[model samples]
Target: MTDNTQHTAQHWVATDYGDLDVLRLEETDVPAPAEGEVTIDVRAAGMNPADYKHIARSGDRDALPVAIGYEVAGVISALGPNTQIASGAGAVGDEVLAFRVAGGYASSITVPARDVFAKPAGLSFPEAANLLLAGTTASEMLHVTGVARGDTVLVHGASGAVGVSLLQQARLIGARVIGTAGEKSVDTVRRFDGIPVAYGEGLQDRVRDLAPEGIAAALDCVGTDEAVDVSLALVEDRDRIVTIAAFDRAEQEGIRVIGGAMPASATYRDGVRAHLIRLAGDGDLVVPMAGTYPLADALQALELLTSGHPGGKLALLP
Candidate 1:
């Protein structure tokens, strides 16, 4: 009898940047762990716009056949040499979730041990896979802007995955959040402890009415010009205004931008992953799931993400 775990694995890859047609499913040998790495039998993979956007934005990149994925949750199947150190190494059968990994859209993956964390009991595999990126981004946004207890902040796209995380994490920090959302999503933002304000013309005045003292900080998850303009007018200090979506305008407007694509921004997100995992496991943070798809149908998942307003995060189940 042969070990099925060592058999070929199926995964999605982008040979070049293009539309949904660019994503192709392929089979390859199951990966073996190198030093300080662990192989996981993936149960769930999280989907985000960044996954597709990263490919679409690349122009004639040298790397061909790039494995496309960022986050996954699964059980450890094997550990690499010298990985057992200080009782921190993940053992076989350990349920774990990891972020910032390549080739996550597969039945199994080998990732660095340092990037893996024990899956929080309070969350299912899908939620655990979804937790790290948005949660850490929210945490970093709050930290970089100095949002504290008794402070009021503005969050654009409050009902989005990252926006919802922002609302929950900001409330956890004891800050009051005034969030911009569509008319239909007002209650969704409110449910996350955010005061929802409709996004449209006169958004600045509406936010001002809600926060008479003015917002201490503003975070734009939507990356709209309106959001940036409103944030600039309301916040006294430009440093307190940040955009995760509008990186190009950040320098021109003299406001900070935190994005995974930016070299300087990774430190803020990487530093907070462990703390975010703890918070989610403790039930202080929640990651809402919009939908889940079989691994082979990842094209539909990417299409749904690009469609916008899916109401929550999408996950891939192998």
Candidate 2:
């Protein structure tokens, strides 16, 4: 499975969309790429809340039996005839990472060439796998909110995967970030260069004290009512408040929302993907791994991810 070869790949399949109980390890034929596609021998895959949320809601649907991972990092195994990307200088067998696709839980995946980018030479497969979707989401959130240098930004759930990514990107743009996390995660937020405020009662007060100049913008990775309420209280303009989670209420509250069922425009998606790959390549992004599970133990992995409060991304190894 580690070497690039055309062979049957075993994948974890969710026979019915429900809880982790529905996920099963099953053997399936390895997929081949159509024109403008490349096949990957998946070395590592990243897991997120969206994986289980989609499974729970997709009950009895035909896509029910679909493969359930969105991000993977691996070596190119094969390329379809029309994939000119592999023919250019420094192409094919290039280690790469990709996002916004299915079938990443398997030993191999067929992805459109345009959806993939050459993995940074410095990152391990697991590290590269961790960056794709979460990094892109963070990038898009910062872009949409127009967060800029010298601005003070408040972020909720600041120690989670997306939160950490957002903190790093916001700092890169020269913003001073004040983030919320459980008391135990304060050190983690501090390590990321964010001012850590314990999340709970008095969150708004803590943020106000941390940034006496006032919060110019807010990004919520945590969808709790507390998170939404605090952001509304601190930022002067609702347009500067963005929630990656609370899209349903964003419009009513006048906060900007990005990355949910609200489809990302192609231009924004491309820009975010490029920034993520570049950050990984430049060593400016760090994706901590909470744990790793064998492909056979995928259900256990999903259970841990859905359990909530895990500090970093859960990875699947084949």
Candidate 3:
């Protein structure tokens, strides 16, 4: 057996806050599991825009040498002392998916047991790793807006990951969704059971034509001024208009904001995590895979995600 106390693993670290150039690979000692924690042999790491945005937006005063990545899928290698349970929340050798880890862009990581869940057998490691964050964010937005059966809601940036999840979840909730996307993504939106409305000039008119009675709610994932304005014009209740991207305007315009940085996002995600997993496992919800890259090529993937909407989720094989 390997010496547990001396095992080493490689991880990606941001040497500084600027761009993808800041990322560097380095070998480090594997962390031991603490109480309520588990050591995972990471097989896949999901990449999202938030991974890079968090670094780019950090000020000079922020510390350097920060570890990057937040979501992963893997097998449990060890469990924390006193964490054994009759429920078997996370046992050694169990394949699992986890989120909000300190540094997921690694071959191995130690995370709180609460953050781990059994990865559904139906999903590959990449798909399971890509599921939670976007799914929960979409679910939380719908929850806060009180979307329900027979309601018609507008979704901005409907071709992106979170947007796709929102469209699927809204349909599962029995709500009608009118999603906005570029011409290239119109078909994608339609395939997911959303009414595809091309975004650009006259978007408001187009959406109005589709929903003559006005929308029941609006979700802005793009944060474009046009998106917020159109949503404001059509959705009568400011409380029903939520933006996952436009926090500044959401504050000024009295609309709700639900993003990772938002205080309430944690509670929402925790409550909905298991439900999202079940839905994905049952094929009631699907996360489209745009691309996959080896761990060493993560910077390229992040660059692509940062460039613009990539139409789906990206995964890093560790």
Off by over 4 Å in 2: 1-6, 86-92, 265-267
Model 3 local distance difference test score: 0.86
Worst 10 residues of 1 by lDDT: 1-10
Residue lDDT tens for model 2, 232-310: 8888888888887786778678788776445564457665776677787788898888888898888888878877777
Q: What C-alpha lDDT does candidate 1 achieve relative to the native structure?
A: 0.86
- Per-residue accuracy of model 3 over 78-129 as CA lDDT, tens digit each: 8878774212555678889998777889999878888888888899899988
Per-model TM against the reference: 0.95, 0.93, 0.95
Compared with the true structure, model 1 gives a TM-score of: 0.95
Q: Better model by TM-score, 2 or 3?
A: 3
Worst-scoring 10-residue span by lDDT in model 3: 82-91
